[model samples]
Target: MSWKKTSITIVMGNDKYPKGTRTATFNNIVPDPTEKQIKSFAEGLQLLSDGDTYLGSEVIKHDQLSAE
Candidate 1:
């Protein structure tokens, strides 16, 4: 068998989380995330996680926030 390599990166925010804090939104017991919502959330997370000491912003699609 041939050897393979993979890389994974994890970044943490500065906020202090409780010891037992865990994500429950993705447990499937609640409503699934829409494609637009997922994309928006991912972009927001990436912006916050980026270590660069510069301010960055982007406009999200209005429909993503609307309940329609």
Candidate 2:
């Protein structure tokens, strides 16, 4: 039984829409990523954004099941 990371989703909060309206998704993330790496990546994205705020990030993963 193993899980594989599929992508990272960055949620952005907008002034007009308080409940976060934008999201940036990056696929094919490295396996078992560190917290620091995810934080740094989100912060870096915040810098490039216009007025959107960095609400948080979501690390999406999926597991494969097989019957023997």
Top lDDT hit:
2
Candidate 1 structure quality by residue, lDDT tens digits, 1-68: 22232222222333344542222122222133454655555466658653322122223221223345
Would you estimate the TM-scores of all the predictions? 0.30, 0.70
At residue 12, give the lDDT of candidate 2. Answer: 82
TM-score, candidate 1, is 0.30
| Model 2, runs deviating above 4 Å | 2-4, 16-20
Q: Over the stretch 19-66, how does candidate 2's per-residue lDDT look in tens digits? A: 558877999888666889998887787788777677888888776777
Alpha-carbon shift of residue 45 in model 2 (angstroms): 0.7
Q: What is the C-alpha RMSD of each candidate to the true structure, in Å?
A: 16.4, 2.4
- Best prediction by TM-score: 2
